[model samples]
Target: MQPGFDDPVFDSQGVFRSVMFATAYPGRIQTLESPSTAPTPLSRAAAALCLTLADIDTPLWLDEATASSEVIAYLHFHCGARILREPGVAVRFAVLSDLGAMPPLSFFHPGDDAYPDRSTTLVVEVQSLTEGPKRRWTGPGIRGTLEIGIAGMPESFWSDWDLNRELYPRGVDVVFTCDRSVLGLPRTIKVES
Candidate 1:
């Protein structure tokens, strides 16, 4: 089993705050010096997120790339979270090693109208993250508009997101993790080029 937050209380709180900040200020990159450790292809930021948000009650689903025994053991030991085989199941959180290779975005659970907040939250690892190939984000969290760039995404990801955006509160939320940085793209964030 791998080590989790050095100081469980403080570390979880810190990471939680950063995740909240990321969602509150969508498209803004947020960094947290995570005290969590995970298997390869998983970022520290994402590991921290798993430790912070996942618990016995929240079912966690991992992509094939990260469904290894080692990684599963790590998540189990640290978060005591359950892992499910299906992404479309009512999982509270899902972890994917490569966003570019993932299945259709809509394949995951999108909460229904009466319980939109029950949708899944995706934590994806990307090859790199930088600012360029600009995109405009406008939504509840943005003051007006925010321009940002992200790399290592699949070519059709933007189009998929466009369709997901149309679903309003019913779509899954996303968190892109790369190295030590984390960026959020909640269901409320609308993206444009």
Candidate 2:
């Protein structure tokens, strides 16, 4: 809807709305439709995120293995965002093709006292998403709240998240993208074992 790009099948506005809803209702599953065929690891959920959040202002960092010219070109063509190499530098968005080898989530921006919203967001693509071992989640967006399970996450992630959560208003947020669906894990959410 901005201009010049070919029309997309899914309503861009609707996609954004669903993203907001998912963020507002953490742990909720949200499905999205992608107009064009995306490469493996880039699911409809990931595409929707790239389309909705990426813009001239956002800086994206792609995993080394997934950092192909085609991927970069497609992102630039569709989202008009800039690609960054370093994770520690200022970046609003990041995509992870191989979640297994991804750097520690703490490597990215975790914001600061004056600007808590400056933390980076990670879009992690996983093999599959399904209900797994049950885990307890509580915090903002959760209504006194819920218990759910997720598949394909490393145990170290939970350990790392414990540290991240302790940072409070200075931690980053994450989105898990699988197939055409996504799950939000806002920084405000606390994952308890």
lDDT for model 1: 0.84
The regions of model 1 sitting more than 4 angstroms off are none
Across 44-149, the per-residue lDDT of candidate 2 in tens digits comes to 6787778778888888888886687767777788778788899865798889877678788788899898897888888988766566666788988888867767
lDDT of 1 by residue, 42-89 (tens): 788888888889988898999998888888888888889889999765
lDDT of each: 0.84, 0.78
Clash list (residue pairs), candidate 1: none
Model 2 steric clash pairs: none
Weakest lDDT window of 10 consecutive positions for candidate 1: 126-135
| RMSD, every candidate, angstroms | 1.5, 3.1
What TM-score, to 2 decimals, does candidate 2 have? 0.88
